[model samples]
Target: MNHTKRSGTPVKRSLKVALVYLLVGGLWILFSDAAVERVVSDPEMLTRLQTWKGWAFVAFTGGVLYLVMLRQFQNDRVMLDRQLGQQEEIRRLSQFQQSVIDNANIWINVLDPDGRVLIWNRAAEEISGYSSDAVTGSDTVWEKLYPDPDYRAWVLERVSRIMAGDEEAEGLETTIATGHNGNRTIAWNSRSFLDAAGRTAGSIAIGMDVTEPRAAESTLKARERQLRTIMDNLPGMAYRCLYDEYWTMKFISSGCRDLTGYEPDELIDNRHLPWVDLMFADESDAVSSAVDDAIAAAEPFSVEYRLRRANGDIIWVWERGRAVEDDGGMVLEGIILDVTERKQLESRLSEMATLDPLTGQFNRRETDRILQEEVTRAERYGRKLAILWVDLDHFKDVNDSRGHAVGDEVLRSISLRLADSIRTVDTLGRFGGEEFIVVLPEMSVDEAWDVAERLRVRVADEPIRVSDGDPLTLTISIGVAVYPDHAESAEGLCNMADKAMYQAKDQGRNRTMVFSQVAGTIESDKSGEA
Candidate 1:
């Protein structure tokens, strides 16, 4: 278009003139000598013009004719050369493009709006396992390439819209079967191609095998879903907090509401009361230290403390958190969990382990622990301490005759009576079976004896009632021991009191004996006092 006009007509005038000049030059050369001689001999011709002038005219005319023919030939040669150069360049470019397409790793295909293959490249040949001879000028591509005809139709519709100039075709990726055997899965990105007139020519598609990447992505998505499910359904609050004075909540799961009476959104980003605000002021330093240690060491930590609830109720809570660090060893992550229920359970279990379940009183271990602590206190404060051990009289007769259920009831009754009998400051625990022990702080032997007699009378006077039938009367024998005077340690005090109790039981039972002497003598023996 740029080189010249596009008419097919030849240069008629130029061609005729060139041929005529050639013929005239040949005829002149053939007859020029004879013709010159005849003109010289003519008398009339001599009168009008000389022979030499005629010869000069012939030479000039012949030369002009030859130059015109030569000029025309040179012009044709120039145009021919230009055309040949252009054709050669076009052929080289076509070869280069073919080589590129053949060697490319990207699979490429050209399709018409009807999902028919139009121009399939060499890359497509290698990938789809189909050659141009097999696929071109045919619609077999749709049958094999598009496993789902409906999906193919949907894509064709969209592509048609693009072809119609309704929209610019952009990346449209979808999974499809590809490869030489037609079993490989690949991801395809398709777009429409426009022709010289801005009209739809066909569609161009580029594809890559992404089966492995897609599988890995699917696995990651599944794991994310599982973690989300666990976090959403956990029984307690789990959260991440910033290591600051506020211990601000950074990420809190949905379960936060159940524990703190605040929604997850309310607590996140320090919107609601933060950890520092919710904790007891006295325990804040301890909480901070625990967190610091954990963060410094990238280890787990736990703290037992009190939490102030939204309703202003002080409730005990156990907080546990672990630190997560970056590759550079910086603590960039934190996980916090609510352990309130667990702490409450631990306290309850400790109580159960150390104290008798039925009596709600300290058991032997608890008694010994308190005795040791009080002995140290007594040594420091110079205060006197005493122990009084008591044994029930004929308590087993009630159990054996009436059933163990009644016996259990009797034990509970005795425990309650013993609790009521002791002073608020004094300590009492069911030692084992029907044996009871009492601890007195800053009390003399006479004071302890008075308290013991009071407890003894209370037990003897209380009528034991069984659910089966009738109420019965019971009695207790008492043995007294003064701490640090009659015995120096818990074991000695327990042994001396136990010996005294057996002596009271021996003196016909229901009697009080003081183990003040080595061969302890019975001081009081009243069977009918109650």
Candidate 2:
């Protein structure tokens, strides 16, 4: 009824419907003709049936056109569905990329081909003191980040290198001074980002604050310098020694030259004398024993021994060391110090306290110390210790007649005689004023009396020929005491022997006496009974 031109599908459907209509119409006409011929008066019925068939054929043709239009509409709907799915996928991928740039921990900043800031992560906002909303679309963002002219030029140079196919710029790590937060230094690692066309669009950088690490490195270097200074300026030798058979010196400070007259290089790495060879033979065992005790206890140790110097002088050194041990109680390290000057000063003070300065003999204080030491030895070994107290008779007369000089000569002569008359184990000391004390360790009272008598006889017989062309003869009255026999305490024994000497003086003034129950009894009378 519309009289419109048909489409290709509609035209094909029309042709198919028309062919069906023709076949149906022909069949109906034939049926009608047969009916007319059969019923001689059925011509009206056949014409009515033919008109109904034509109306049915028109309806079928309209239905075929509607079906073809519906199929085309369904195909168009399917294509629209596939296009919607692709658009959704593209939106999801864009959101994922944006989330990655926003949530990353490292500072990531991207710039467009024209050097305008395009994207900035959260880390970059916090570090650069500029938010993404402020920096995005800013063409001079890097200029604001780095204000120094030289630093900006350096960054541009690196960027140029990256654009010229140089991958070395990718690994570029450097410090930059940013104007933000009062011009602080930032360490950044940079890489070039390329577009879909493989052209370098811009650069992305990650940065952190490296000032603290740089300061820490500088402090470590300063501390090392201070340690070296202290080691170099120390007064005495400081050394690190190994625990091997050689006890090789691994490190020796510069003070080695002052202590042992050896250079530091000569001692380090066992270039010169080893530890065992440094000490005297007689003292090596004692030093080793002390070291062993220190190592076992993880404590400090000290020993006084004789060390041979480079000048062949046997200097007495006091060595103090500490043992450094591992968890297993093994000696892993050792630090040694030289105490030679301290030892010498101690020895000098000891000599001043114990020796008579005029005669170079042991004083009363020294006599007491020697007696106490001998007492300890006697108690330990079940041996006897003897002591002799000798006084010069008529020595005051020499001082009264000539002078103290002449008396000093006589005293020196007596001191020599007394020293020459005793064994090496015996101690001879001046007990002040013309009086002398002798300590004999591990000797019986009999042997002590013999030694005292010999000293007395020698002093009396030996005369001093003075510069005044006169000979002065003197005799020594001695008092002998035995430890644990005559007295027990050092003080008690000295007092007892002193009383015995006075007793001898009261009896004749030139004789040897022993402190006994009978006080004034002379045991030997070796002064020739005067």
Candidate 3:
């Protein structure tokens, strides 16, 4: 803002003005001499007026110079005023920045490379329980603030490194023993001010109190550790695994030993073997496929299957897992528990519901369900299905003449004979008392009739050997009905087969009859009515 006024500049410019005046006056004297000589005859009169004329010429030139110079002075003054105003604004802005630094929520401290505090803000004083005077004047602030000598030295090195050009700036996290207020963790970004030659003048650090957040993070880690302890003691094995075919175990809880007869260390990172290898080989494919499907849908899955333990004992396991994608990779976390007992119980119950208790064949209820499904499938695909209604020709006679126990043996024998006669895909069920129903999928009426005849012959050829009685010959009559040909629905097909079996009985038992005879009669009636 300061511009020195040169001592001789004004005088020099004034001398230049005087020289211009003298040059002009000399010109006037030289040019006007002849005119004055011709105009004035009296010499005394001319001399008296000449002095006044010279004074007037000097005054006129001086007035013209003053006016032009005054205009120049006004412009210079305006420029000086503008410069002064700009300087004032700059000073105000500098003051505003200082105010912001002093009043900011974050603690600010400017320190010399020697660790002497140069500037301490109000926030620093409030947080550290130190006054501005105490902080700024004391070069040994770290003596009370950083109790550990090593820590104090480390803090001092932060600024010293910047000063020594080893670092430009640093982000610092440290703990400060704040007098009686205990300790506070601070996160700071420190930058050093450098002189023109790039030597560090001092360091300014802007920092925030991170004590609460650090404490919260500590609490969270403790809680997680607690939860992990609970999971380790649980009955089931909690596992986090890599998304691979082996379901490679990452973290296996302590329950692994009790659950799988293996220690946690033996399973983690697959130290002993892959966890997937624990499963039955076929079951492994099924479980991995299910897990992959769940991963594609971003969902969880549950399955029950057998696993071979380290003790070489096979046990059923119920596993539930969830797939999560992170960092463009996948992680599967799950729990596996021993469900061998539960699975055995369920299987027993299911078998009791589905299979015949006396004959060990499918019961009537399951038979109906299978027949309905086969009928629907045949209808949907325009495929054929056949129902064979088989009746033991003289089952009641055996039960009446012999004991019920012998009848049971005979029924069991006949069941085995019928079971051996049918293909694997066909279903056989006891149709209440002496009648057994057979469901043949993808079999036409002729094929069903052939099967029925074959089964009848099989039963009759083998004389059932009973402990109490002689070998008795058995005969079975069968009726065949085709789906969507004789009847459309499963119930309709069963009814048609039943009626055909009665027809076989009336035509003399031990024979197979197709339902088309009845259907032909119905069609003939309809034709006659038409």
Candidate 4:
């Protein structure tokens, strides 16, 4: 926009003006001289008039030259003013462009074809901690930014390829050592410009600092690894799933293979099977209801249910979960643990509390409970109920001769035979040592007598084989009592049955007796079995 201004008119234009004036004045002089000669012949007078005409021509020519020079000067002034206004506009536009570049937030730098820094903006200065004065017209800033020789070489090569149009510069990244900050990562985009002749000129590169974003990405990846480790180490399946009947899985841990005999990928998205399909059909409704209720209450849920594995084996599982809000809407997050072993242990403990250890029949306490329940049911329905009280005959003599182990074996064998002789609806239990009770519901007194006779025969007809001795012949004495016939209450009925049992033992070692038959007997008439 700046150039030297000439002080006066151009030499070529001034010479052209002088030539035109000479031609016009010469023509006028020749014409005037010819006309004066033709009009007058006197020598002195002609001389005088010619002198005047010469003077007049000189004056007029002088004025014409003055007017021409004045007009030329005015035109030159107008041209000079226009040139000045154009230069001023060019300077204003250049200043505005510089201001925009300097105020931009991103780094902007330009390099010459020889790799010298041509332009560096304020942002580049702030980011690199090198002022424009320090970086412009020099290439040393590259060494400061890339302190490592190998890295610098790579960066330079990449930039060269980009400037040569051999490689794209979009999203190109580099790590630089900053003057103030320890280090920074930058993402760059670049373009090469051309001169007026379309020849390769310098290049401009724009960069954004990405150090913080890269650091955050690294931290996020590390935490993801840690979370994966924890999930893999867990003994149960950890999951995040949609709250639907399919329990569509979004994420499932590696422990799923061990828990359900299905891989995580198999269960995710119900690729193989829906989570609900793994539960027992009978228990699914109850489990679903429990989970739904807990979710409705905005509380956590805990449920124990059976699951069928991929191998088709059923196992008990305990699940604890809660509804959680997620990007995909409400979902379930939970853990499911195998609880088959615990359930088995609980079952064993329950059996121990209510079953006879040696005979595997209901124990005395459980028998009493059953008797009371049956009595209540029969009374409510006006149904007949009967009980048979059976006693092993001469069982103490066997214990005294062959040891208690053999005697226990005989008792167990006899209990089994008695149990086999009754209907499935009848309840048989070990009432005490050498005695058992059989409860029959909806049975008349005569029907009870028949069942008691069958039980007595069933024991006497078989030989009880003991592990320590040869098979021994065994017999049992049974006494029968009917509800509402012998007594009203469970306890009274039991007493009547016991009296009948003692009466049978007194009458014979192997027989049946009714409680009514022994009720009228004198107390002194009751005797112990021989």
Clashes of each: 0, 2, 0, 0
| Candidate 2 structure, TM-score to reference | 0.61
Q: Estimate each model's TM-score.
A: 0.67, 0.61, 0.52, 0.81
Write down the worst ten-residue block by lDDT for model 2.
Answer: 328-337
Which digits, one per residue and each the tens of the lDDT, describe model 4 over residues 119-233? Answer: 8888888888888998899989889999999999999998788778677699888999888878889999998888999977989999999889999999999999999999999
Best-performing candidate as measured by TM-score? 4
Candidates by TM-score, descending order:
4, 1, 2, 3
Error of 4 at 382 (Å): 3.0
In order, what lDDT does every prediction score? Answer: 0.73, 0.74, 0.83, 0.87
Residue 330's C-alpha lDDT in candidate 3?
82
* Candidate 4 wrongly placed segments (more than 4 Å): 1-99, 517-530
Q: Is candidate 2 or candidate 3 better by TM-score?
A: 2
Clash number for candidate 3: 0
lDDT of 3: 0.83
Name the 10 consecutive residues with the lowest summed lDDT in model 3. Answer: 521-530
The stretch of ten residues in a row with the least summed lDDT in candidate 4 is: 521-530
| Model 4: residue 309 alpha-carbon error in angstroms | 1.3
On the 0 to 100 scale, the lDDT of residue 140 in model 4 is 92
Q: Encode model 2's per-residue lDDT on 49-163: one tens digit a residue.
A: 5576557656765686578668878988897898888888888877865687677766777766566787888877766678889889986766786677788888777766654
**Residue 362 error, candidate 1, Å:** 2.3
Q: What is the lDDT of residue 288 in candidate 2?
A: 81
